[model samples]
Target: MYKAYVFVKRGFVSMLSYRMAFVLTLLGTFVGAAQFYFMAKFLGEGHEFPLLAPYGGNLMGYLIIGTTFMSFVGVSLNSFQGAIRGEQQMGTLEFLLMSDTPLHQILIYSALWNFLYACLSTSVIFLVVVFVLGMDINVNLGAALFILLLSVVCMSGFGLMSAGIIMVTKQGDPITWAFGTLSGLLSGAMFPVELLPPFLRTVAVALPPTHALIALRKTIMVRAGLGEVRSQVLALLALTALTLPIGLVVFRWGFNRARTDGSLAEY
Candidate 1:
């Protein structure tokens, strides 16, 4: 029991030790959000999307929320890659591995709790968007929460998997870019997917976030019921299934490889 407390305490201490980095992280994320807001305000002038008509309005508010939430989702899921890099840098991966408790359980709990903390902190700024900036956000309370939760979990699975890759090769830029850019370009964050070439639109739907962001547009603008979101829901479900299991499986393999190589403690 006391051991569990020590683990939690250690994680918090690690987070605090990098206070400057954390501050930079907070500020940088806020700047990114602001950049998106301005970009949307620019493109939104004197134009309309036909698909957005089903949602009964423009996509500006939807873009604000989508960009904000995707920032969370993108960073959160890819957290594992960054985390493994840190562990390697600390030169404590092996020492930590030697702990009495199961390593998987410890890592999962620590990662998840910190991710939740990120979500809370990010959401505070999101509220500022609607209130301070005076954006007309037609928020649907229930659907917003539901879709947000769905997005978070889906992203986490990707993060854990990416971390596993880092565990093996200690490199992640390629994987991160593969997932991040693909989602960014095709997921309809800045504009509708239909604007992309037909081939790109098809590929975009293959990315669940494409559907997820569209669903968010509908729920916030049209007050879409959960029933109205089967496509988005199913897409997220399928991606979650693929990402989580594969991530965990690869993570197990990577950890074992690190152990055998005596590189578990490599920084």
Candidate 2:
């Protein structure tokens, strides 16, 4: 935990050094939120849309919840890989790998700051959507938080998997790219999965974000309790159980392979 704190502090310092980037990031959050707000208005409330019936029939609310959750999902999916790639680019990955710290811990600790920043960004989006944009949300804060936790853990498994791939490839990562593209398209981030065709809906159901978004929308938009979205909760739990172990194994294997091939320091 202390290591995580140190990493976060370092990241904060880094952000401070890049004031314009930090400022632009915050500005982007507001711009993104406003875009969603206006897009929903242009599309109408969607109360007449059958696919949105279960989610209180509010287009803005659905979009806000989906986009907000996906923001965290984006962090969880890319942060670790980005950390590893950044370290490689800086010629520090090998030294870190040789250290006493377990490789997994190094990667996990490195991404901590990204998750923290994502939380800040997400809060900004939510605030802008609910207050500045006047979007009404009947949210169960406790349940919403729990769902967010589960979603991150579930998605982090995939992040670890991508991080492993980047450790070897040192460049393009098919895992993150494929997941990022497919997730945004099929995970119902901007629309209800019910609108998808049968086979596509099946694929959408298989993605972690789909379940996460459903649970988030239910809990945040309809103020549903944990039990109300228990199915989505269980799906996330199951995915976490299945993916986390696989991610660890894959990462360990990649680390060992890179070390054995004397390519750990190669970029």
Candidate 3:
């Protein structure tokens, strides 16, 4: 835990060095939300989209949840891989591996700052949607937080798998690219999963982010309790159970292979 804190602190200080970028990112968050807000209102008003029925036909609120959750999902999906790439580019990968820290700890902690930033970004989006856009939000804080944490764990598994691929090949990871692209298109990030065809819907159901977004939207927009989202929660738990171990094993193998090949210092 202390080690994680140190990583988070280091990340925070590093982020502070680029104050303009941080401010621009925050501004961009609002701009993105506003664009979606107007679009949802324009398309949803006086129109019946069965895909949005679960959200009470409030497209803005539905989109707000989707966008916010995807922000975190984006971080969890890319942070570890990006961290590994950054370390390699900076010539620190070998030194970190040579240290006394367990490789898994290093891998996980390295992305802690990204996750923290993601949480902040998600919060900002939610605030903008609720306050700036005057969207009504019913937040079940406890359940929403639980779903968020589970989603992070589930997505981190994918991130670690991607990181493993990076460790070995050093670049051009089709897995990460495909997963990010498909997840964004199919995970109900900016829209509902039901809008997809049956086959694609099935694929979306298998992705942890789909279930996580559904549960999160329910908890936030509908003020649902944990019991109400039990199925989504269970699905996410099952995904985490299956993927986390596999990701760890793959990452360890890749790391060891890179070390053995003396390519850890190579970008």
Candidate 4:
């Protein structure tokens, strides 16, 4: 509870400090949505001489949502790195490792803060876009929330996997590129998987964001009910069940190994 409240407070304060950043982020997201909306309009209208109609007419709305919600996945992964780096820089990294509080809880809470803030922030902007763009997809909020809950579990688990790497390697640059490139391309942030090549399609399916995007699209674009998105829901559940705990365990091992190596704070 303390950690949750701390993060919530910090998120609010951080937002206050960077009001323009939030606005620009929302604007950029909206622009991306508009670009896709046009592409979908042209191609899906069956007047574009042929290309990407395998994606369905709702592709634009899918693109809009899939791209925007990706920010939350990015957040859940590196939540601990920032605070760890800060503590390390201040010579408290070792102290944290030595403290009574479990590192896993710390990491979980840190990611929770990130996921919570990103989701809450994006949701507001998403609503604004819905109103502003006049998007007409049927949205079942309850189903969407359930899918989102599952996606968060999967995403946060993937994040912990990355955190495991960070704990041992003390390098976030590689992690950044890994998340950025895959999240941008493989997740179909700008287009549907059907629009990608066959080989790329295989790789996209391996990503958690792929299912999250699909689930999100189902709820928002096709407006699929929980009963209808059984596959996506199962994908999310399976990913979360498999990956999240493994990530936590791997991160725990990494942290302990680093401590043994006397490099817990060494970047």
**Per-model root-mean-square deviation over C-alphas:** 3.1, 1.5, 1.5, 3.3
1-267: candidate 2 lDDT, tens digit per residue: 887888899899999999999999899878888888898998884437668778888888888777877778888888888887788788988788778888778877887788888888888788877777788889999999899988898988888888788778878878788878889999989887777899998988778999989988888888999999999999999999999898888777777778888887777
| Candidate 4 per-residue lDDT over residues 167-248, each given as its tens digit | 7778764655676688788777766677788998888877778887777776776667888778878877887888888877
Candidate 3 per-residue lDDT, tens place, 58-142, comes to 7888887777777777788788878888888888877887788987788779877887788888787877778777887788999
**Candidate 4: TM-score?**
0.81
Task: Provide the lDDT at 173 for model 3.
Answer: 81
lDDT of 2: 0.85
Give lDDT: candidate 1, residue 258.
81
What clash pairs does model 1 have? 77-159, 88-267
- Alpha carbon lDDT at 93, candidate 1: 63
Residue 226's lDDT within candidate 3 is: 94
Which candidate gets the maximum lDDT versus the true structure?
Answer: 2
Cα error, residue 153 of model 3, in Å, equals 0.5
Per-prediction TM-score, please? 0.83, 0.95, 0.95, 0.81
Off by over 4 Å in 4: 18-56, 86-100, 173-176
lDDT of 1: 0.72
